[model samples]
Target: MYHNTKLTGMVVYPNDPEYQQARMNWNPFTNAFPIVFVFAQKIEDVSNAVKWARENKVPIRMRSGRHALAKDFSQTNGGIVIDTSHMRNVTLDKKNGIAKVEAGIRVGQLVRMLAREGILAPFGDSSTVGIGGISTGGGITAIQRTAGLISDNILAVTLVDANGEVLQVNACENSDLFWAIRGGGGGNFGIITSYTFKVRTAPSKVGIFEIIWPWNQLNEVIDAWQRWAPCVDVRLGTILEAFSKANGLLHSQGIFLGPAAELEKLILPLTNTGSPIKVFVDEVTLLEAIDFWAPNEPLFDTQNTTWSSTWVKSSLPEDGIAAIRTFLERASGSESNFFFLNSGGVMNQIPPQETAFFWRNTRYYMEWDASWTDKCETQKSIKLVEQARLQLKPYITGSYVNVPDLNIKDYGQEYYGDNFERLRKVKERYDPENVFNFVQSIPPAHICDEKDIDD
Candidate 1:
């Protein structure tokens, strides 16, 4: 491998001792071995690695937590992988309720650091997911209903552009770049090095809920959830996840923030609609609440899975719910989960045009996820996700970027909607050469469409 061994950061080849660990990401399905893995130790190391990859004419795969769903975004067959896991650093400005964190930090790492200071930032679901990817792609957290997404909390960021020069971007300086990073998906603009965010103080009391029902009742529960979940108080947010148990049974679960009594009151509608096998709700510290819903790691051990999702302006109608029910009943062919995530919390408080994330009119975001271990079974799992997507397509108006599955055929249009053009102009002004291109990259206007380009 052509590597600068004398460089400060460690370089690992396929045969290196840490190769397997370095390549192992949250998403185990990505199967690619870069010629060289640059384990960058510092900001300058990240810049140098990027410069090296550019000079070598090598395709680059940058990893921050490596939870990316698309194999193309985090894996390259024979290229350079810039591994940033070692650069985790968190500094809290308690007075300002803000935290400055390194790109390599994970949601759990940052949360723990901030909790020590009685501060909180709206990060994504998993603690292992790197903040760089999460914040850049518009992070949605359990706390989103209260403080907005992690991207919305971004007060400043130091990113390395295509030219390998670091630029400080924020609301005032490099504002366009800042907007793109908030929700435009990462790797399309630049490599984010550090993010300065406006963290919020945690609520004195946080609530938790875990409920499960029979597979047959999914339609009823979903129909009821879609009607009531979003209308819950802004102090509360709900994530309804449908999953299969180890015994080959399907289940539905979620997380909410509020007092247990109040949460139970809000959830009474579902209890009345369906017969649940398990139901538990309680209140706990905002920090302790993290483990209440799921104290253990929640990811399945499978690489080959297909997940597709979209947003809807209104709740699914009876026919829509019926279609989803049909799919859910048939979804036992593989371990699949259909989820509904309510969007209005602090997210709605911000105007749709204020940032690139344009799901304002949509009340909910939905996902059809399927996972399997065998490659041969991949087709079956994919079909389940596709069936769900097709059924919900009529109601889906837009999409979310952080789910890691950016398979929307017309990615730019679906993910960004009306904001696609503005993001493209920012892409030109910042990384004109498309140095940050990837599987779901925002292509320049001249290369894709003329009317979309901004002056």
Candidate 2:
């Protein structure tokens, strides 16, 4: 009956000349050889791809920017990848202070477009991460404490459900679905085509700061940052990173919605905590700050990347700091490091259980990133991150669904917290057949009760 929704996307099969480029994933460590790839250009293209995959008995993997962090999350061997990468479009409503953004638009492109109009929203550090993933996964950014998460800003979404039916989800309609989509993770309940987000006018100028210290200052820097970052002024949002010993550096940077002198005073405790080799502070327009944070060229060019993130409820103890030093000392790859995105302030003002993003009260977000240029070092690189995660397990509780780790035993609870059960119920209501299945996807209540046989 729905055959009229024919597949109109550009399909690239295994034999296609561009197949290699088409199949590349952001985390090359988890690359897959899908049977075919569909670069969907419109909502009809997405609907047809989903229906065709179901009819053909081919597993479906919905990808926004190929940035899924774990194995088989966004790409699957012998299955079809229905990608929204080509569907970049946007409609701004300055009157309502909102925007209708296509799911496939990259963060950098979207930020630039909004900056041109003197508006912006909460976004992640990597300019290449797709808006669909970042928004649904609960975006992290330098302005999070001041602006709130990207999901918190979402007003509505137009998504195609697993049954080839498009639904409008928002606060007043399909409200349960809206709550689940906010932070339940991307490509879970459905494939969102576009999102209506609350956008704010960009500040003409904001203070930015960057500081670096010698590798030996790891303990001092982490101790100072974790103690100060989450409690600092509400106008500031920052990140602390400890590079591998081979790299020999500790970097901290942030965006402050204030003047340079004001930020300088706020960060004095941190700047004075450790012996910093480089310290710089300046005031720039919001657009300039975005550019300063982003890479000059497009991102996702790195290969063989392994990444995972967790919710930090409290400060990491001294033992935790030592563990990081120990791991970096012998980490196999030069790209291994620890990343901490500040939390608290306005972001934590919202209570948990309000939305699917249950880690609203987290002190900070921690991530382990490991990369290797040589393929032979893959296991070593991944293991280094794994070892680090195990060491910090006591200090960290939940994991970010965006940076999935297959090694986690019970991912449902880890990712969704108590909201996991609620998410399952929503899944049953919208996708009783469990059509959108991934490695760590939330299974409907029926499937959880052992009444199902296949994914």
Candidate 3:
């Protein structure tokens, strides 16, 4: 491959001293080494890197915060890595209630920046996660029930296509690409350089609550939570986590866009289910609540930590509470847990066809995750996740794209549902050669024959 000396960003080869540090990801479970790593400083630098990769016949993997659960999606054995971590510019329009944020900014930075202006954008729970990954995958946060997913608040996007052409996509221009990018998942479409988001006024005071029960009451607490949380006031967003008995606790926590007294009254059903060992509720500013929920963390903080492989599967809980309890009873390690994210309110107000995100009608988004420290326990832990999935298969309809799972066979329907074909068409139009593709990416429509399309 011929190197381009005119490129604006710094490019590092295997021999470079910085190469080792540049290729590392947040998750230590998988190892990815690329032929070249380009630290993009500007939008034009991304374009130049893409053109260089195409000419060299090398695969290109776009990375932002590098927090992807499915590590393989953002890594290639011997390809080019286009990292956008250096482009962290954010411009705000307070009067217009809009913010133009670069792809490299972390969710915590975006949240704090907006908080300074008494405004906010819907973001995920993890502060270290990248905005580019979350927005594209339909981000859900504590205020999601009120404000909707992060993707829903996006006004427009500036993308650099596979051919290295700059494209401005929005409702009025490049509408198909615009529609696909929102909740269509990243790494399938072009690289998003920046996002224009519609911001909302931050509430003066919000309620933050956490309640914990003994493991013996997991079933009762989960049942009460599922019936109450999703049907509560749209202003409240909550999550329930049932940890393994080794952890010895079942907890429910969330944020409410109101005072603590009002939030307590609404969540009484959950708190009253079992003898709660601990209960805490307080009224604080939105920023205070966010910090309490997910504290700010360093970017590359995973080294020397106990590396664990994680598998996640999502579903809409129905009559599966008993199955979930049974699965947890036979779970493998202390790190294993099951989570349910309340998902009604404004999220269900939008029709599924309105965007590529098709799980609007689900009451709650559920995830079953298992982690292990030792290599000997890896397969056993993964098997536990798979077994739990099999038990809940009769009730689950789809999975979340943010928590990608390679174990899924029919990923197209599982992730995109009926919108898969349309996404495929959009992929053909934007990346005809499948330049931006990976294991679970939307394949170009032409590549799938009639038989595969029918399936």
lDDT of each: 0.73, 0.86, 0.81
For model 1, what is the alpha-carbon lDDT of residue 1? 36
RMSD of each: 3.3, 2.0, 3.2
On the 0 to 100 scale, the lDDT of residue 395 in model 2 is 92
TM-score of each: 0.92, 0.96, 0.93
Q: How accurate is candidate 2 locally (lDDT)?
A: 0.86
Task: Name the lDDT value of residue 161 in candidate 2.
Answer: 93
Q: Arrange candidates, best lDDT first.
A: 2, 3, 1
Off by over 4 Å in 2: 1-6, 449-455
**Which 10-residue span in candidate 3 carries the lowest summed lDDT?**
304-313
- For 287-313, candidate 3 gives per-residue lDDT tens digits of 898897778877654431121112122
Regions of model 3 farther than 4 Å from truth: 1-7, 298-319, 450-455
Candidate with best TM-score:
2
> Which parts of model 1 have CA positions greater than 4 angstroms off?
1-8, 244-257, 293-300, 332-334, 404-407, 449-455
Model 2 TM-score?
0.96
